[model samples]
Target: MYARKPVIVLLGLAVCGGLGCAQPPACREGQVATPVSAQRHPVAGHHLRAHAHNDYEHERPLFDALDHRFYSVEADIFLNGGKLAVSHRNLPWDSKRSLEELYLEPLQARVDATGSVHGDGVPFTLWIDLKEGGREIVDTLHAVLEKYPMLTRVDGDEVLPGPVTVVLTGDDKAKRDLVTRHSQRRAVRDSNDYSPEDPPADSAWGYYALRWGDYLDASSTGQLDASQRARLACIIENAHAQGRKVRFFDAPDHPDAWRVALEFGVDFLGTDDLRSLDTFLDGAP
Candidate 1:
């Protein structure tokens, strides 16, 4: 029992460390020495929001990126029956990992846990890429969102019941347009077929999410082909003209894509590996 006592104490310390506890400050008598300044963590600005595509499929789920302090995360959603399920495909949607359970719930917990805000002012963006078609999913999501007041439309900038900023992503431009027209919520155009000219007058597009199919392969880097690049540049310029940002995804998950995206002045580069993207943005060469 005597030897076992030390083992128990060590185990407790390990558990504490895993839960993000810091060591206690040393002191002398009743007075303590001046404490060192807390190290300032880097702020992820409009550079690249780390995206965990189909995060629910990962063995560890969203916790891995959250534990590493990822600024943004992505979860694909599909409408199965009346529930908003979290999955890449509609055929095998898991009831256990609903959109609320896998994405919104954990995210809400994080915002509650951190109490951190953008610029200590803006709400954190939760990018939801929809996989299935129909107004049913949108309605279901809207209903779920209504329950959580912290989430508000970015246009209003009001503090809702939650601190998450929800952005919808989908391939169906017409459907997305219909949702935006009826509701006041914000949505992004994630299609290669659509252009700025066709954008709605009161475009709810706060950001443009480009996929892997949208880019062309360069010698050693990923880029939009000549015509595609020109068109994208124009779209981005026009989008910015309307106070919107541009984001790209499905590109190489390495320094190559990061370098190109930065050079092109993209607002966000989506990646599955948050740590790598974070490091690259921090000037990893």
Candidate 2:
């Protein structure tokens, strides 16, 4: 698996207009596109809800997370010379790392090889954080994603679960445009701005990524007091009841935090320490 060659996307002229050049057909308002289910291609493997935060920073990007059997992974990207490059910053050197080469194609290859990323029917998430927002960037991403049908898709308001689910993060406008502009797409949006009072999960906003400090007041000891625990549990329950998977990022990246998140039924536990998290989850009850 490690021996697979990279598939780089050659830069092309980015034309922007109505429907934004995404090749996938858009459904009319109130229409539903075809449904694709991941269960249809089920294979068997231990699928963990671990999320590799800033996964592109790792030595192997998506592969490292998959090696650890992590079901979720995140990558930050920016538009570089008409191509989407994976990086947290707009460093010129980062342009060499195309999103397609680093993450998309490898995931496509995995889906083809194992029927699904893990063959366990548990949806894998590829979180793409857009460093900047614009029609060109959003259009380019949708255009690129149109090539991969392995992604979980949105047909009107319905979700067609596929082997992998691509969630757009970072720029709020770009994420919204992805859903509003296109009626059919291979990706959904990830909202960190969600509140307990917010409306139920729509087809576009699939996950809630909360900042730990924003909701929980934990000390350096990593212990959650009774009130903090209550708050955390309330937030998780509220999000789950609305049909949105929850993830807490910018949290203490240690066993203490991980334990609390697991105990509270937090859906995707964010961590940069992939191997440690894998071992921890394996040893966990």
Candidate 3:
């Protein structure tokens, strides 16, 4: 179901998508320049918009995504024996990976080593999708997150941005409780809906995560048409205006879908093919 060969990029890996393909600019040779104060960041040219969906499913989990320079990563967790076990299903006994072990610990280590996830102090997002246990699981997560000082914190109306920001998705009531109930929390909630009529973002709601199929149906040929493109643009525009970043879950995990997302200025593009998306975004303007 996935395209093995990379799309979007044509000759010289120049991506035009549906738009007219334009030749890449001529390269100016031998214009190398160096700054007086030299410093190397691990992900110097990282794509700030790349999101690793179901990151834990990968062989290396969080590390794999970081190696590819992904700015955002998602892990699905379920409550098991009062511990947050990372998995997509409710098999607690079968899963031994804890959220702390899989994501939080490694992230904290990276922050400690580089003063940030990528040595750039840019806020990285750790999106936790609650699979079950509702309030119990969320509370457990909050406790675990609090132990890590690298996570972003909120005191009243002030947001202290740290190296990592935890955004909780799924379990609507639990997420709302985390936002409304706690005055000080290490994590925030992700807005599942993106309605133009909805109120602006607050401390609780920092991102808009919509399902791909909820908005538009692909044409008979299973591709987005002009109308879909326009609607997507409007959705992203509305999200941006509301001071909330936008990302679509379960979106088409390929270059064609990625092109439309980039064209519409989607804040984060979720993909299982990390390397392909990284390469595609790298080649994009």
Model 1: which ten-residue window has the lowest total lDDT? 1-10
Q: Of 1 and 2, which scores higher on lDDT?
A: 2
| Candidate 2 lDDT tens digits, 1-285 | 011122222232122233233111112233322221112113222235689999999988888888888888999999988899999888785544899999889889888988788765666889999989999999999999999989988899998989889988888889889888998999888787656566788888878877665555565535676645655766776667688888877888888887787777777778889988888777665
| Residue 40 in candidate 2, Cα distance off native in Å | 22
Cα deviation of 277 in candidate 1 (Å)? Answer: 2.2
Q: Write the per-residue lDDT of candidate 1 for residues 1-285, one digit (tens) a residue.
A: 001111112521211223443222112123322212112234544332455555666666777655544555677777777888777777665667787877677666655666643334335667777776666776777668666545654333322224666667764654475356545543333443334444432434456666543333233345434433444455445555556566766666667666656655566566776667767665632
Number of the top TM-score candidate? 2
How does each model score on TM-score? 0.67, 0.82, 0.81
CA deviation > 4 Å runs, candidate 2: 1-47, 93-96
Q: What is the lDDT of residue 262 in candidate 2?
A: 72
Q: State the TM-score for model 2.
A: 0.82
The C-alpha stretches of model 1 lying farther than 4 A from their native spots are 1-42, 45-48, 91-93, 117-122, 154-162, 171-178, 181-203, 212-217, 223-235
Top lDDT model: 2
